[model samples]
Target: MKSAMMEREGFAALVLRLRSEGISDINLLTAVEQTPRSRFVAHHLAEHAYSSRTIPIECGSFLEGADLAVRLLHRLRIGAGQRVLEIGTGSGFMTAVLGRIVERVISVERYKTLVEEAQTRLDQFSIRNVILRQGDGSNGLPGEGTFDRIIATAAFPAIPKTFTEQLVHNGILMCPVMVDDERCVMVRLTRTGSRFEREDLFEVPYLPLTPHIASYL
Candidate 1:
């Protein structure tokens, strides 16, 4: 009983920190509050789940920092009725969060092990809206049909045109792109008719998005 109370307190504090960081969306905050991030992390690292720092997951990938994930999600302006495409599943924490906010989410990951593990976590949370697929997301999954929003968790040297092409008219795509040899910046692209409008959000530190499916874990 005491442990449950502590977990609740930790989540409450996390919500406050996100709000202080300028996350003003009530629904997003509620989703963040309700989702148990601990369930998405390794048992030994569960204590750090509610903290803002990234936690190592399987497949040599790291769950993105909570602050960074929330900031990006907020900027995407995700609507409850929209369908979102997530380029990286990571620990499935962000996938669960997006599942809570959107009507449907199709997340692709390069590692099959990560996909299976993430599916287990999502199942534990009873999140029925998310579909986890194992694939290379360097170029978005065009066969899944267009989405209302698309977000890539890894960094890219430049915006991949294939990803933008997969967006529905007026759909939004958020990603991190290398601005120089030493720096990566978060970028937002919105599809309008035959053109895409671009905006650079902020600098971020992320490994470049890997291409092709992993042959082994």
Candidate 2:
């Protein structure tokens, strides 16, 4: 077993790295530390889990690093007792972090194999509040009801109407939207009484969010 002091030191280093990147939420950082990125990454790449690098998963999808996840969650401002809808459940790392701070998480994935793997990863950590579903995540989960916050792990050519309609009044949706063929920007959409306001956060690179179930393994 690793020494308690070593764990603390490692966690503190992670917190510092995230803080330097402008991820100021202490709760989010703690959740990231507790989730341990190493647990969700492939065995060969486990050593670099905490670094801000995208890693491949079972399918063609790449797991967004802790830095991206932290930025998305911080902008969402997830709070206790709130329901969150996550667009991609890659490796279930983000799902686990949101589960720690939110009442519930409804994560949708396009690949069945990825869904199963992500579910197993969450089970390993004993995280029970995330509802992992296999389907196209471009359209948010309707049956689960409107969410207080929604985060998309993949990039979309445009904000889908379905997501805006499913967001509760005063709810926020954070996602990376493709501005051109090659450029993407993280945006925040807030819904208030049928009106939605948009704010662009920053530029980011991510795979396109597909509407069809993935055929590629």
Best by TM-score: 1
Error of 2 at 112 (Å): 1.4
Residue-wise C-alpha lDDT for candidate 1, range 1-217, written one tens digit per residue: 7556767887888778877876778898888877877777777887777777888888788987777878888999898799999998988888999998899999999999999998998898899999999998998997788899999988999989888888999899999999887889999998899888899999876788889999998
Error of 1 at 106 (Å): 0.7
TM-score of each: 0.94, 0.91
**Could you tell me which 10 consecutive residues in candidate 2 have the lowest summed lDDT?**
1-10
Model 2 agreement with the true structure over 104-177: per-residue lDDT tens digits: 99999888888888888788888898899888887888777799999987889888888898899899998889
At residue 89, candidate 2 shows an lDDT of: 83
Whole-model lDDT for model 1 versus the true structure?
0.87
Error of 1 at 57 (Å): 1.2
List candidate 1 segments past 4 Å from native: none
The lDDT, on a scale of 0 to 1, for candidate 2 is 0.83
- Looking at candidate 1, the ten consecutive residues that score lowest on lDDT are 1-10
